[model samples]
Target: NAGVTQTPKFRILKIGQSMTLQCTQDMNHNYMYWYRQDPGMGLKLIYYSVGAGITDKGEVPNGYNVSRSTTEDFPLRLELAAPSQTSVYFCASSPLAGVYNEQFFGPGTRLTVL
Candidate 1:
């Protein structure tokens, strides 16, 4: 299984531009999440989905949107990009949310905005 994969390892977007960060997992995990980490900061959850058609906002969902239409895919969209949005984005999945489940993270996408 391809665990998790994200497109465009690196990107540079201008202010006000919009882009979609693609994420897909082949493990058939029911729980997926999107997170962003800024320099010298811990990762902050942006959005999460327990399953298809069920998504909830997380700690920092202000500048982003997410949707889960299948067990293997969860994509995040960023609108009106800003410099503050420049960070490393990660997509992760877990079989469950409790202690017994381990989250598998993607390689991560690094974005810079000007």
Candidate 2:
């Protein structure tokens, strides 16, 4: 099964523009997350969903938003993007709450905001 997939492998945006990064999984997981990795840095969680119709903000959710309308899809929305939002965004998924579950990450969408 396709663990996770993200669209627009790379993108360049100007200040104040908007964009949506699409993420999907076919693993039937109940936990999905959106994380951003700055150049030479670790990942910072932007948003997450425990299940369909249940989404929540994460460590760094200031300039972003997300929705989990279905079990397989979790899309991240960036409104009025800024240069600070330029980073490699990764979409990850895991099975239902269990300490043993390992997160599966997408190829990542590299966005550069100028």
Candidate 3:
């Protein structure tokens, strides 16, 4: 993605509920990713897709689902939300996978599970 991404900026969920956090980019990036950051911790990759219909698990893929059905959309599904899942989620996209690849991130989705 060349420009900023778009995502739901905040969410509050109850235990056991499910919700889909959607991300979209119009710049037609081939590499899109999902990550989460807990309090005082660095970002942990959750999932990523190189292109439409191709996806792979990242470092922390538990309790989450993702699919790249189209080039412009990648939605992260949260099932049975738990307090541990509460964190700042980010969606990012890049044109290529390389050392100097530049990524554009959404503002962030702050999820609070109660």
| TM values, all candidates | 0.96, 0.97, 0.93
Question: What's the C-alpha lDDT at position 90 in model 3?
Answer: 94
lDDT of 2 by residue, 26-103 (tens): 999999999999988999999999999999989999989898999999999999999999899999999967767689
**Cα-based lDDT for every prediction:** 0.94, 0.94, 0.91
TM-score of predicted model 1? 0.96
Residue 95 displacement (Å), model 1: 0.5
**C-alpha lDDT of candidate 3 relative to the true structure:** 0.91
In candidate 2, where is summed lDDT lowest over 10 consecutive residues?
94-103
Where model 1 places Cα greater than 4 Å from the true spot, the runs are: none
Q: List, residue by residue over 1-114, the lDDT tens digit for candidate 3.
A: 236455678889999999999899888899999999999999999999999999999999999999999999999999899999999999999998988788888888999999
Compute the lDDT for candidate 1.
Answer: 0.94
Q: Residue 53 in candidate 2 has what lDDT? A: 100
User: Model 2: runs farther than 4 Å from truth?
Assistant: none
Model 2, C-alpha of 13: deviation from truth (Å): 0.6
Lowest summed lDDT across 10 adjacent residues in model 3 is found at 1-10
Off by over 4 Å in 3: none
